[model samples]
Structure formats: structure tokens, C-alpha cells
Target: MTAKYPNKEHVTYATFLSSNRREKVDGVEIGTQFTKVVVNHPLQENEELVRPMKHCKTIGDVHSEGTSIAWPSICIQKING
Candidate 1:
């Protein structure tokens, strides 16, 4: 898909709901934890496949990774504490 924000980066939400071809004692198959971010909005058919989002909260590890500014002290405290 193409869009105005083709270069803008963001995260999308997806879930592994079911597996059709798998043999288990309980007849259940575990799915994947992989989530892919789409540069453009997902198609109509992919709407139910994943939940898309524009943003998410930053975590505390950002500072430990050697970044000058992760977030404000108060913001980090509010999130981490």
C-alpha cells in the first residue's frame, strides 16, 4: 500500500489467532508473537488481521541504551515508577 507517510515509522498490533493445520493432543496450536509495522495503512482484508496504531509509550530502557534524552524525568518516573 502507498501513503503520504511512507517514510514515517510506527508500530502495528497483530495476534496469532488460530492455526488450521497442526496436530496436538488437545487439538490446539500456538501462534506467533511477531508484529510488523506497515508504512502505509493496511488493506480492507487486513483490517481484521491486525490492529494498527499511530503511537505508543516509550519505556525506561531508552536511557540505558545511551540516548541523551529518553524522556523527561517526571515522565520517566510516572511511567517506570
Candidate 2:
């Protein structure tokens, strides 16, 4: 994604899945889940000094291939002395 400023300068962003949980994807009676995204800071021209601005992106903007859940097995074991 690219964002343009007043001067028409564009910024490129490379987003990744910093962290996530099952709850975010689906409400399975689990705890709340959050997704964190990081962007590559680029140099921007100002009056004199160049500063790196923080990029803000919504969670919905993220794209995923798919998701799967691994349920734990429940069984009883028998022991003999």
C-alpha cells in the first residue's frame, strides 16, 4: 500500500502478521485476539530534517490465505499393576 502526502510523495508499506489468535478469526468462546502490523519506515523530506513517520493500517486490511484449528484429543487411559 502507498500513501501520498501533500507534496505528492508516496510511501510503500510491507505488512506482516506480528501476532494473532483464534478468537480474532472466529468467536469460539475463547479470549480476545488482536493482530499487530508493522510497516517499513521511509525517509520523508521536510523543511530541513528528514523524519520517519509512523504508518497506521487497519486490521481488516490484512489478507490471509486460510485458517485451521487443532483440537486436543480427549481419551481415557487404563493402567494395570
The candidate that wins on lDDT is 2
The candidate scoring highest on TM-score is 2
RMSD of each: 17.3, 19.5
Collision count of model 1: 0
Deviation in Å, model 2, residue 64 alpha carbon: 27
Candidate 1: worst-modelled 10 consecutive residues by lDDT: 70-79
How many residue pairs collide in each prediction?
Answer: 0, 0
In candidate 2, stretches whose alpha carbon ends up further than 4 angstroms from where it belongs are 4-9, 18-36, 43-81
Tens digits of per-residue lDDT for model 1, 1-81: 111223222222122222232312122222232212122222222221122222322212221232111111111111122
**Residue 77 accuracy (lDDT) in model 1:** 12
lDDT of each: 0.21, 0.25
TM-score of each: 0.16, 0.20
TM-score of 1: 0.16
